[model samples]
Target: MTTITLVQGDITRQSADAIVNAANSSLLGGGGVDGAIHRRGGPAILEDCRRLRASHYGKGLPTGRAVATTAGNLDARWVIHTVGPRFTREEDRSELLASCYRESLRVADELGARTVAFPAVSAGIYGWPMDDAARIAVETVRATETSVEEVRFVLFDEPAYEAFARQVG
Candidate 1:
């Protein structure tokens, strides 16, 4: 069983075996956690992303899907990039959001990663409600089976931390 932990801090600063980046479909680089990871992890991450784009991810990474890249300057050995679905009331995309966490773990497992740090996924500019996002993340991670020993949801703010805490508790 994996132990879930919540921390109120920057995901980019977390030292784990892998860090999950809530990336856009392009997977090249975008705002929020994506930008932060690329900025701090240096050009190596973007170079890997570009290579992915040119090879396997020609159409860009699909929503809810995940891929791994070198961590570069970050403390982690690898960075797992997963794209979260945009929030839209017209359609129920909760499963897609959930898949972001699930797929990240799958990739982490393949890489023999024991600890993973994740951001709030779709809760940022994607417009997912923070509370609901927390619920999906916690529930999905708890339900999924993997070799990962610890999962850390690293939040950038107090409200986000509290929301995840409620779900974790």
Candidate 2:
């Protein structure tokens, strides 16, 4: 069985095959997890994003989609960048939030990654509630089909850890 684990720490420090970035559509880098990944992962990741922007994703990566780039200075071999939709009351965008996890795993599978780490995605600056974010993350990863042997949710704090723990338990 594919194991799902939760860790409370910096996602950038995890030594998995790939780490999912809760990126903005620009993918050039933004606040929260995106900024941390790009900053710690170094210029190589940004260079790749620039190339991606210059080449294919000029309009920027659409929300709910994912693309991979080199991990740069991080322990992981790859960084899977996915844009998470901002939470809104006008429409239900829960599916898009779930897609971040699904698409990241797809990218990881393409890279033959056996283990991957993910953040809380929209739960941060995008304002998706932590409980709902945890629910979608866990449920989507549990239901998705992939070759990844381990999926770790590398949360940054105690509340995030407890939220994911409730879902995992």
Candidate 3:
């Protein structure tokens, strides 16, 4: 069984085997966690992303899908980039949101990552409610079967941490 952990800190600083980035489809970089990872992980990350763009992801990564790249300067061996769905009341897109966690874990398992640090996918700029995002993330990780030994949700704020804590509890 995988142990679920929560930390109220920057995901970029967490030293895990893999760090999950809540990236936009562009994969080049954007605000929030994506930009932070790109900035801290240095040019090598962008270089890998560029290569991915040139080859497999020419139209940008699709929502609910995930891809891996070098961790670069961060304290991890690989960075798994997962695009999250934008929340909207008109439609129930919770499955796509849950896929972010599931797919990241899939990529982690593929990379032989025992420990992975993840941010709150889509809860930031993408506008997914914190409680719902937390619930989906925790529930999905709990349900998924992977080789990862530890899955850490590295939240960026107290509210986000508390939200995940509630679900984790």
Query: What's the lDDT for all of these models?
Result: 0.96, 0.95, 0.96
- Candidate 2 collision pairs: none
TM-score of 2: 0.98
Write one digit per residue (lDDT tens) for candidate 1, span 1-169: 8999988998888999999999998888889999999999999999999999999999999999999999999999999999999999999999999999999999999999999999999999999999999999999999999999999999999999999999999
Give each model a TM-score: 0.99, 0.98, 0.99
Candidate 3 lDDT tens digits, 32-91: 999999999999999999999999999999999999999999999999999999999999
The TM-score between candidate 3 and the true structure equals 0.99
Ranking by lDDT: 3, 1, 2
Clashing pairs in model 1, backbone N/Cα/C closer than 3 A: none
Minimum summed lDDT over a 10-residue window in model 1 is located at 23-32
The number of clashing residue pairs in each candidate reads: 0, 0, 0
* Model 1 TM-score on a 0 to 1 scale: 0.99
lDDT of 2 by residue, 1-169 (tens): 6799999999999999999999999989999999999999999999999999999999999999999999999998999999999999899999999988999999999999999999999999899999999999999999999999999999999999999999999
